[model samples]
Target chain A: MTLTPTPDAAASVLAWHDVSVSIGRTAILDRLTLAVPAGGLLTLVGPSGCGKTTLLSIAAGLLKPGAGRVETRARRIALMFQDSRLLPWRRARDNAAFGLRCQGMPRRQRLDAAQRLLESLGLAPEDGDKFPHQLSGGMRQRVALARALAIEPDLLLLDEPFNALDSVLRRDLQDLVRQTVTARGVAAVFVTHDLTEAIRVCDRLVVMAGPPGRVAFSTGFAQPADARDDAAVLAGLQALWREPAVAEALGATPGRRRVTA
Target chain B: MTMATTAWIGRVTAAFLWRGWAVLVSLCLLAALWQVGHEVYGGLVLPSPMDTLRALGALVAEGVALPAALETARDALMGFGLAAVAGVLIGAAAGLSVTVGRLLEPLVRFFLGVPAIAWVVLALIWFAGSGLAAVFTVVVTTLPVVIIGAMQGARTLDGEVLDMARAFRAPLGVRIVDIYVPHILSYVFPALATAMGLSWKLAVMAEVLGGTAGIGEGLSLARVNIDTADAMAWILLALIMLLSLEGLVMDPLRRRLEPWRATRGQAARERRS
Candidate 1:
């Protein structure tokens, strides 16, 4: 979860050292070096095909980097993909406890933990026994979240996990993720294209450039911890939007101001 | 007593009986045509429906058909069970490994293309009028279909669900039983059901061609006697046995394994009020 060190010092849980990945002779991630501080929420933001997903894939051990090493102190890791990916055959609670059940946990224990998580996420007790098709889209995503959390993972990776939800539901889920991950103290790396979601949920932001993805920019929140409004966060985001390198990399007009404060 | 309620009941009953009536009427028309053709021909070239039914009833009364029918059922079940096991294993392997799929593709296609007569002749040579002829016919006719279904199921599985399983480091057992099995089963069951029917038909052909004792043997004997009505009667009996066997074995098992298909029967009460 949260690792707070003395002022000006930070701890690291997951790190990548000069990682590069190639697919069919084409480089996808090139010299992508990143260090995620223990218990900090680091958000990766970039345009499509910019290797944000690739970077997360390598970190989760789903893909091996061709040229570099990834170090992870967290033995338990959970990844949430963009599609929610609920198994249509399994009931919601069984889906939620998938990892644990896969880990050979006792059925009763897994069921109990799954039930608790479903309850925490506002799913009815009976709803846990219903199949995925019976649940709405928002409910499916919530079940996916519950599945990941049931493992009690020390590290969580999310790839645009809330993209399918409407704006209000998205905001509500963002708040839920914020509160849940903080309470659990899990280190999370969230990938998103939404600038506002990045500002709201991420403690730090890393942007990547394309073709052979490289870290293009890194920034901290401009607003103090007390201010979480759209206006204050939008000010910092607007500044990043104006960066000539960011604009050039993103293929937008190099120095245009779209938001005024 | 409300007229509207009575009319509503009448309409519902009519809707249900319409399809049943259509099926019954078609069967009656077919029998009439067969009877007229036999009368016009004035020979055993085609048997009249009454003649065939009388012959079938006499065969059953004399207990001449029970043993053959029982033997045929046994062979069908054995062949079908073997095919299901082999099909699922090969199908899963093909689905999981591209290399396996590539290597087996030609073999699957070849087996699928192999004529039923060719297989029957080969099986006759190998098993020589034993139960294996029937079993081999069933396997040869059905395995490829199940394998194809399994491969398709595996290919089309959602990538995200797979990634989730991998992220958790799911073991082989969990991966198959949970993630892969359910996904593939929806494909496998229908294929297996259809295959079971094919297995019975092919088994009978194998028995007939291979000179094995069973319903097919009885049909062959009727042919030898030049008893056209008896042959037709035996064929009808075989058809009835096949349908009843599928209803008794395959249908119940499928309904149990795939309860969602019977949603109206069990889950109707659970619908949101």
Candidate 2:
């Protein structure tokens, strides 16, 4: 009954099948279906308050879907919250190693694993000894990311992981996340409000529509040319934004502003 | 070199003198009123502040007074320590589990609501004029406050933090130490300080009633001998010692706990992740 992952098993890591979620008397997600490919970065993007967070919560198993089913390859799933939820009392390294420690790993070994993962993620060797309050906003998020990464989860869910950072730091963290998860070949579902940021990091994009979230748009990163800054990508983005159903569901126009896709 | 050092010394002395003068002025006003009362009622009924101070100094120089005060202090410290440990453990258990909390909370409320004097009488009868009676009363007076305080600390723990702990698959020990302990320590220590004060007050009161060897015994002896000045003198010495001990023990502990307040404060303000 151990929670450790059996290695090299990635196919259909997590799936949400006809899942609908409700909070209190109100329905938030309406019959939505999504799947994460093994070692794939699946980004969920939508306008504000459009059940993106709810879907992420359900996927992380923090919130149970009101109806339908959620299946996953591994029972152990870790979610990195939007705000770095590092325990202020614990040092950066202890917080990082928290999940492994929970798995009943021995102290020195847990510390070693946590240290290695954190160092790989650009954390200084000494940084793990500092408490969360002593760390800045960026550093705390990095610690949180390290904690999630240390668990070596088969499935990782992130809720707007870079929402609070300045643009440069956000880009750096985005790159860091991509590099770390890709190296480990872990399945990740990253939720973001930005289109370009999603495009930059995620292999595929799944966009949720409205309050009772439905899959309004789904696309893969199959652009032959460099679509990040290309005129065609911008035009296609605009066209997607102008889709009558998308515009109606989300009140904001899909304006062509450079954002973390 | 001499001039500058002299100037610095003079400034420091002047600041000290100003603070001393303020305290001296208040003391003089109190003394003058006390003198007026002694003038009206005469020596036996109401003693002047100067007479009480002189009596206190004489009692201390006699050497027996210090040992008596120390014994009383030792008893108070022991009683407070017992109350604190019992209260926090019970409170944390009650606060963490709803079934335990609901079952035990009403009993605590009943004990807290019962008047202090009632417990003193009951403890005196139960322990039969022994030092245990006084200590028992002190515990009764202080335990409920500390228990309620620890319970409040436990209830205020952030649910989101617990969820984070769960997601990380933290063991029970880790959850309690890194998560629960830091959150509860701030609330527990301040309540402990207050309880220490309460225990001391109850200890003295119980001694006066139960009549054992302590400051309270001395106070009762003063009353029996009809020496009003000596009684007031013992009361004043007891107050000074209680204040001193609180500053000595609890103040440093509170200073160590200061950093935790900031984190708990932030947790209170945060509504969601």
TM-score of chain A of each: 0.91, 0.85
Q: What is the DockQ of candidate 2?
A: 0.28
Summarize candidate 1's per-residue lDDT along A10-97 as a digit string, tens digits: 5777888899999999999888888887886888888888888988899888999999999989888889888888877788999999
Global lDDT of model 2? 0.79
Residue A195 of candidate 1: its Cα lDDT? 70
Model 1, stretches more than 4 Å misplaced? A1-9, A222-227, A243-245, A255-257, B1-55, B125-132, B151-160, B224-229, B259-273
Each prediction's DockQ against the real complex: 0.39, 0.28
Evaluate residue A119 in candidate 2 and report its C-alpha lDDT on the 0 to 100 scale. 82
Once fitted onto the true fold, the runs of candidate 2 whose alpha carbons sit more than 4 angstroms away are: A1-10, A48-50, A112-127, A166-168, A223-236, A242-245, A253-261, B1-63, B99-118, B121-128, B222-259, B263-273
TM-score of each: 0.82, 0.75
